[model samples]
Target chain A: MQNEMVAMLLAGGKGTRLFALTKKVAKPAVYYGGKYRIIDFPLSNAAHSGITRVGVLTQYESVALNNYIGNGSHWGIDGNNSVAGILPPRQTDEGASWYQGTADAIYQNLDFLDNQNPEYVLILSGDHIYKMNYAKMLAYHKEHKADLTVAVLNVSLEEASRFGIMNVNDDYSIYEFEEKPKNPKSTLASMGIYIFTYKTLRDALVKDAKNPDSEHDFGKNIIPDLLAKKKRLFAYTFEGYWKDVGTIASLWEANMDLLDPSDPLRLYKDDDFRILSEDARDLPQFIGKNASVKKSIVNQGAIVLGDVSSSVIFKGAIIEEGATVKDSVIMPGAHVSSGAYINHCIVADNVFIDGSRRENEDGKEVILISK
Target chain B: MPHILGLANLHGAPKLGPITERRSIASTSFLGRYAFVDFTLSNFSNSGIDQMGILVEEKLRSLVRHIGNGVVYNANTKRGFCSIMYNEQYAPAPAYNNDINNLIENHWVLDQSNADYIIFAPCHLLYRMDYRDAIKYHIQKKASVTMIYMKCSDGKNSFINMDELKLDENGRVLEIQKNKGAKKNINVSLETYIISRSKLEEFLEFAKDTSHFFSIRDVLSYMTGQLFIHSYEYQGYLRAFTSVEDYYDFSLEFLNPKVLNELFVPEWPIYTRTNDTPPVRYGEEAKVSNSFVANGSIIEGSVKGSIIGRSVIIEKGAKIENCIVMSDAHIGANAKLKNCIIDRYAQVLHCNDLKGDPKKPLIVRERDIV
Candidate 1:
């Protein structure tokens, strides 16, 4: 097996379910937790996994996404050997149109994979939060001599129908795959993470492109077609805090999970799954004499004068005297005025809650009071 | 003549004002590697002004820590480099209001050194300006009060207006237009000015004697023609983060290399207490191209043309492009975020997709949910 592998990031989805949060920005650009966007996870994972050459397939709202991913310099994906570019829809001999499906998105950007001549192509979705070593997955794929490998995780049987369900033999070879079947064959669900030999992926993409009846999706089209050809496919089990925060409720729940002091999704721990990001010039947090805080994660540059409990306060936030904030996530420099009460809310950056206010009593409404 | 004591409102504006409302002004902010209040303190210190006192509304703990002994700005000596001056009540009070007269009285008590010249400066603004030059301009013209003014396109939004500049032959201001709509051109006040210490003392005495509420702006307006109230121009960048929008705008401006050079240039260093964090580390899957990341960060994502802060985590499969993420943020795996502002210690859950407009970015405040 070669040390070099090409990773294709599927970032073209519209992410319509994210609602108003993704109205202006792409779904990936939507903020999560206290101070991060959904896209940071996959990008950081790729960097940590040591797969330098990356290709991001972008479509909706690609302009901002392109500008953000300019040559992928921040992630150390630069130089002649590394290729990081936004592959938007282009007019070709096949026909001029936007990406019809996931397979099509990758098929159109085949040139990027060809130029790299990587032994393996790691195809992954741009949304999903988990930490795994792709190098280890690649080693698994090579050791099995499998033509293709899909990362599978055990989801609840009730929710298995929502994903691409896979049945594996004792040897770990995938025996069957069903897309959103009414009755899922097994609880094992494909996480939309796949590693395929360069040739196998290229052939599958080419065949799928020629099929007029195909929807061009991996589960809907390519995987079924590959199975008919008896192509070797294996399932690799992944155990971690993996989630698809596609809807508002799911996104909210994921954030709530971090509030647990002992939550398994700890990003601050210096362990194998530590989350990595860029460094900014942030100052140390200041807790005032009047400030009474407990069981909270307060970052640098935060000034707390009021009462904070079970909350996460970002840097440069000012909680004025007489204010009470509980079970909330306050962004940097957000001002909670005197007598303002915030409970179970995620306050956006620079949001100013005027004097003497009550918000988020219901817990379902995420208050966004822009200043 | 009224003596003017200029005090910078150092505690008024937090990075994100809402987060700091109940917090004291002494508290630190996202600029931990640099103290946000240091700019104003250094300006006053370098001006060689004696007997200066800092008026802190609240959040004094972190502020005191950063300005420990005032050693860095040389305000901790026998001469009183910098002192945390608050509103002293004849009787115990509920809360302190930022009244101009109360501030004036505080200055009077601290003026045991008997420094005749008084200036009031605010700490909420970002600028490396010289007060000595403005003071010189005030003295040369024998003006009773000289307010620092910056050119503004539309004059209606400013706290004070100087449409008419009555300057001497040497361009010294003699009079200022006070009435609104007097002229379309606006010369906004930078909220710092020089005043005769005795004149300010007189105003304070009058307010105290009558037990009347007096404001600095009201005094300036009342004695406009009687005293030689004039205006001085400031040429450099001066921004006050009075609102959340302002804070976001000013922070993003640092992404521009020109703005970074102008602000952090060696000739005028913006001093702040430093944090000792390890240098930024980049992994192989990390595809960072044409971006500026500070120290103490670990990049493992696909970041392009972005500005990231210390101790940030970009998980694999996550693609962050054209965004500004502050310190200690964690990006979940396979999430896609574009053209956004992520405040400190934020986490983007796995497989979340966020995209912001090119012009209007989606700003995620500290400790917030996406």
Candidate 2:
């Protein structure tokens, strides 16, 4: 399976719905579950699925993302056979530009995909939080000889219209794909994950680039074009925890899922899944005296001095004495001053909450943007 | 002893007390301020010997979860920080033992940096001492290996014997006897040693041809007559907790303010991965005296002469004396705990009476109830 598939991660989305959290860094670089970034889910899933060669697409401020994922050495993506790299736009015959859409981004970086010459191309969005074995999806795609396989996750009818709804036949063949249709056909939603045959993707991208009317997106242009051509696309149903962390409330809720003392999206339990990032020094996490944490996820390099309940505290965050944090997402280097109370808040890195302030009371969620 | 590479072998050892239940040493073990492995890594980092590797055989989830990037020990740098070298294939055959040398070679490769001096220290031993001074002493004496030694007064089972110690006029070790028995023992090896990088490379080459079961002590014993194997004396508090009693005794030593200060004062800060818990909140009726309470604790009860961990809650009217409460534990109201090491997430119900002797601290593992 070496070099059989190469992954192209679409991490450049502005994620405007995430609000103030994505104000400083790219949406893919948003800190999730204390120690991990939002992009880690896709990168880890891709690596675990035997897709060693990966290229991350970034347009927004990718400094933190680049620093966090330096050369992809942490996920065993070094050496000759395996390589993970960040593919930013460069000057070419097509001219240098930011990624307008997912399909346009892939069309611009066709040279990078062509160099690897993988049999299959696995494209994924970087902002979703879930643990999936993409190898299983790849196996299904291979068995069915699909030109494109879309990872379809089941959602309730209410949430179906929010995603790219997929209408599948009895045999799991995707009959139609609709992007946020008011009148949806089915409850199976495309997770924005597509596995395309290398030739098929390249041809589709080239054709899409020439079409002036196309919006240059997989759901908006490429999938519709593929459907018009009667392409062989199947849906790989996923029955697991999957959440699109597009909004502040959703991101907060996704983090809160980890604190559920029962089953959670267990990224740490999956040995096959590997989070590819720059390796930090491996030191044991320090748990301070007088800390009263329950069902909280804390990363290394965090210094806790107060009470924390059902929260996700990122690496290097400091919760000073007499502070109370509940149902919140505190990023790295964030300081909650003494006697302050933070509830249902998403605090960014390097943010300092003033003493004794309860800003997010009355359940009014706020994303504290770093200055 | 010649220069030797030390593997903590945390997975291989039989742990008693709170350590046995924990996958790795809990981050909130030391009075909820630091992880148990902090003492070992800090000593190595402060010594300026950057080439270090940790061998993890089992319970890797906790180990990986805790040691993310090794930044606490200042090992997170452009140069070699630390690598968790795991054997990829587990082919259960006699020939697999032949690959031990390959594993050692990989360890050497991981530690291949611009460092000149090499030392191996394990996490099982707890002692706060500057190893740089010892390394400096070794270089000045022109010794091939300098093993740190402590004089044990108690007549207990010792791992290394130094009865044949021959010291010069300047108190430098001339020779150390390995197998000799005596009434009064002067030198006992602490298993920590310094060796030149080149000498370690040569030793690796020698071990490649020898039996697969070759121990580090075997190499040390081999170079006894050819090279100058000296000893560096360590006089401060040094205790090896291989047994249950040893761990229990070492834990209770924190009750005394002097011992606690000795371990923490003078700016010898033990660095570990810090958590993001809030400051300990004492309820209106909380009464704490002569105890060390870590951050994120909610103390509504009476805690005296005890060390409580992060996120622990002693409900109203509960009395804890001379106990080590790990993180996320809950002591119900009116419960009495004495001389116990409560593991993480343990819940002592209301009015429960738990007590144990100092030699044998009451052990409650994670998620347990009394």
Candidate 3:
């Protein structure tokens, strides 16, 4: 079957900065926003954009991520005409090998893409928290007749050097691509999203695989190599709430944004733009007679009997009476006993916190409880 | 080991005043997020009874929509089916519509199922049980029909308008009498019957020749002494919804953790259709106590002793006490609502004080803009 576009989600990153939360699971499978995983954002965005096929490449701690993305029906990407598949490293005529890098991951799955025969390929990172329509970017790439288009977000000048800077011309045509330059030339930073003509991407991947000295990375090798060859590269500016939840602090901040009334990332939308996830089959949240919750988000299966403020509580979490939670993110199945107080912390799944074993840190740092 | 087919019979459901005006009692919203039928359907699925049929008496639109494809209930798409059977010919005639007649109307369910026994249950009386153990007891006793009942100590106040059974020493039901709330301790019938398929065919034929108005309950009452009928005691959480007052009181009783824990088991999970919605967001001014809040709700007010459904918005300064607000309801700012039942998509705006008596709670109809 011939498809206009197919999304290839890169979900194999081992988020070490998230600490013990990603010790057993991949970065994409980390719990986020009470009821969803981080990968749900990109998968839901692809589905909402009407992309029919998706191939997710998994490497580090891929079992959970692979299981969660089975057939992609949770995002409504599985049906008679549409397909969602998990592509892992496999043994071939050459030999058994793991995915080397971002470019190498797609290079290894060229046979799978050839089977779908898609004209355009959308490369997505599964760890970011954002909502963008890839179809609009694809339309822009087609209209400009460019070989490649990278989604860019206008960051502040000070933060520009922290990201891969895209130096573009007046017409948004990219002239140079720098990976975290000391003296940044532009505020337009690459959002790690890219769309390319299938033939162009496939040829570049084959050439990159042949180079022994190449790092086989997308931002480091392929993108710069394409720019050095003077290929048509353009920047598609995306103006929305985007967050790279690469660290514990960033993940906590992203969760806190959901509780903010004026936050731009509105999850309580009434339209078709909804972030879909797996159903945990939980009952409605129950708040006890003594509970007081403010500026917080609580999901189903949670039973709250304490004072909660500025927090995000996931499914099956419990806060007993006399326990106070403030400025925290309680993952699924975590329990806080009575007389315990938690502040500015990220309680991992299944962790039990009590008064005697409480972790009371200053508001300056975010405490992580995985035990 | 008999091949049993489950039937969720909605014919005996009582009219719950305005709450059930547009929908059947089977489809009535319960506990903020589930329909009354979800409990019965979940029972079948959890009990490993794959083939089941829902006999709809009336008001089927909401029920049909809620049980779409029956996928949430783990219904088998190929072999076993979750069929919603409605009698179109006699649907307009309530007196002529009964489970016995509906079975005869949709005879394909009985004809196609390769089963030796059929379990008929009700939606109005919500409970959780594995019918496999009940079937084993029925088969071992060699009873022609098995009736499930519970021992109610508070019979005077609860289980009103339901059936009470008079049993013999051998656990045989001597008589099926209606509960008039005359006794404090009595055996209340749950209206769940397990009958052999051949015997079910005979009862259908008997009711057809008796009268068009004769329901299956009447048939069971008539043949109580003649058939080898037995009663099986079910000891668990069970609530009967016979009137609007009963619905109001029983729903509030679940606020107690002890009572709620008896119904919600960890291993035996109750399944319902899931709306992929975000978690409930409570604003800075929110104060909630003793409430069940579903997902996608935005609360900026004070809610005490209430059940808030999905996507409901409670604006700042609004006070909701002892109310049942359904999905997509909007309570405007400073609106004070007490002892009210707001239906789905209803907006209680510009009405500062809308209170009702605790005995008879007020109901705002579906999609009503007040």
Candidate 4:
């Protein structure tokens, strides 16, 4: 299977940091922005960037994610010989095994990559939220005459230590790399997006998989080894909204960012990256005579009879009379019955609260999960 | 699969008052997301009957746009066939539009189709049914024609001017009489008929010299005691929007839960063209209750007891009550409305109050700013 360029997405993270949200669901399968899953962003981005040969490597809780990305028709990546496939860890002749680490995972699937025989490989993470045209990065990689290019986004100095920080010269050639340094020298944090010549990536993965001291990782093992060998590594800067929703607080705040009037990640902004989701086949939302809603993103099939401000309500969720919901995220099928008041909380899908009032004012967000 | 040939606009486009002012009733937007013909097409698709022929009359631009390629109903596939038939010489009139002549005009599709039994349907009767079992019932009895009907309790209101069938104990058609608004268990024709290809060929020759014959109903009506027409009782919900009162009543029927379930169910899903509009967004000051708001709508005022279609904007301080606002209609600030049907993209100016009777809905033509 020969292709122009193939995208390999590592979707193996357990996302334990997201707390109860990812207890049974993969991070990518978590609902976001009212209607879409987290994985829709990157898959939509790659499909729109005209890089259609995508293989998503999954390890944990891939059932929902697998069902969602079927045939990729939601993003219009199903025609003209373009295909998207989900690849889970499977048994080989040796034995059934899981993906040990990022580098080792690709190494185990090296034969799969060779089948495609791509000239260049774009490696990406499945957990990040952003809309970018990777075709531009691919072009920059070809023009730089480099063997490896790392896509980096600028983060705040305080947030730099939470990511793999990369230091590059003025000409944009990487000279030093540190995996989450406490006292970082650069604000250019690694987006964990990599593009490499197929041959270079294959050779590096093979060598890294054989090293006992190595961690079999991209930022921890592969990048350091390549830099040690003086491989031509360049940094590709990206300018847009990017957030790693790895924690509960970060995920909660990231959702609130959609309601921020000044935030650039609003879904209605651009037509090119219109994030597509599964059609829930819901009717239009209904607002009652006394319902007062403000500064919210509400989908179809909702019947609201109370006050809702600064929240995101999914389809089919109902807020009854005398109930008030503010600064909350209510999933589909969740019901806030009459006389109930909720604030700064997350009502999971289909969870119903009886006629009572509960407020979260301890500055710590509350998450309600239905049994 | 039965050879499906639907005679669109069983009447013509010029009737139905302002609803069909621009498009035929077959192409009329119904129930927010579907065209009137979609229910009939969905019946064909769900019943595994592809290879359909739709007789196109005047004002079919919106109908053509909605059924473009017919991929939504799987009529755009290589194996599935969706034929839009046209008659170059056929004319349309309100009281005398002949579907039998339209059939004579597009005889080629009927001739080339592989199926032997033909299912002829009119567009106005909205119901959910599987025509397979009915076709089987027709074949089992070896009947020349099977007329599908329902035991409608509320038929007297709209069918008063139309004809109803009187069936005997054996379910055979006995008599045809004008519905006089006196019966409770009136047998209303659902406008669906199953006849073999040979019988259709015989009717084509029979109707060749009869320019006065309008539909198969015309022939069957006159030969009530002579012809062996069987009646198949359809126990589902049926509403014929032939009159403006029927249309307004049917539009508000979705507010009832039982009617909604009978009209739309998951097993027999209604297929329609999918629009690429965003979800409805409710502003902070918006107050909405007991309404069906479609996708891409923005609400900032109060709405009660209404159906708002796609891309509608209800501006601040506006109050819409018992109104059916179609797609892209704008209810300007403080425009109180009651009992009206706002056409697509029509705007009601600021602070304007409009009202109509519950039996008749006031219509605003498409794209007209009031």
Off-target runs (Cα >4 Å) in candidate 3 are none
DockQ of model 3, rounded to 2 decimals: 0.89
The best candidate by lDDT is: 3
Worst lDDT 10-window in candidate 4 chain A: A362-371
* TM-score to native of every candidate shown: 0.53, 0.67, 0.97, 0.87
The pairs that clash in candidate 3 are none
Which candidate ranks first by DockQ, i.e. highest?
A: 3
Question: In model 1, how well does chain A match by TM-score?
Answer: 0.89
What digit string (tens of lDDT, one per residue) describes model 2 on residues A7-98? Answer: 89987877898777787789998878766778877877776777789998888877767776677765656656887778877788757787
Considering summed lDDT, which 10 consecutive residues are worst modelled in model 1 chain B?
Answer: B90-99
DockQ of all models, two decimals each: 0.03, 0.08, 0.89, 0.46
- Model 4, residue A97: C-alpha shift (Å): 2.3
Over B249-327, each residue of candidate 2 has an lDDT whose tens digit, in order, gives 6766765646755665434656665553433445546666556566556677887767777678888879998788888
Instruction: List, residue by residue over A146-206, the lDDT tens digit for candidate 1.
Output: 8899999999989988988998898989989988778887888999999999899999999
DockQ of predicted model 2: 0.08
The numbered model that scores best in TM-score is: 3
Candidate 4, clashing residue pairs?
A284-B293, A287-B288, A287-B289, A288-B288, A288-B289, A293-B284, A294-B284
Between candidates 3 and 4, which one is better according to lDDT? 3
Please write out the lDDT profile of model 3 over residues A1-371, one tens digit for every residue.
22699999999999999989999999999999999999999999998888889999999999999999987889988777687879888999999999999999999999989998999999999889988888899999999899999999999999998999999999999999999989999999999999999999999999999999988998999998999889999999999899999999999999988887985786886358899899778889999999999999999999999999999999999999999999999999999999888989999999999865556556788878888
Give Cα-based local distance difference scores for all models: 0.68, 0.71, 0.91, 0.78
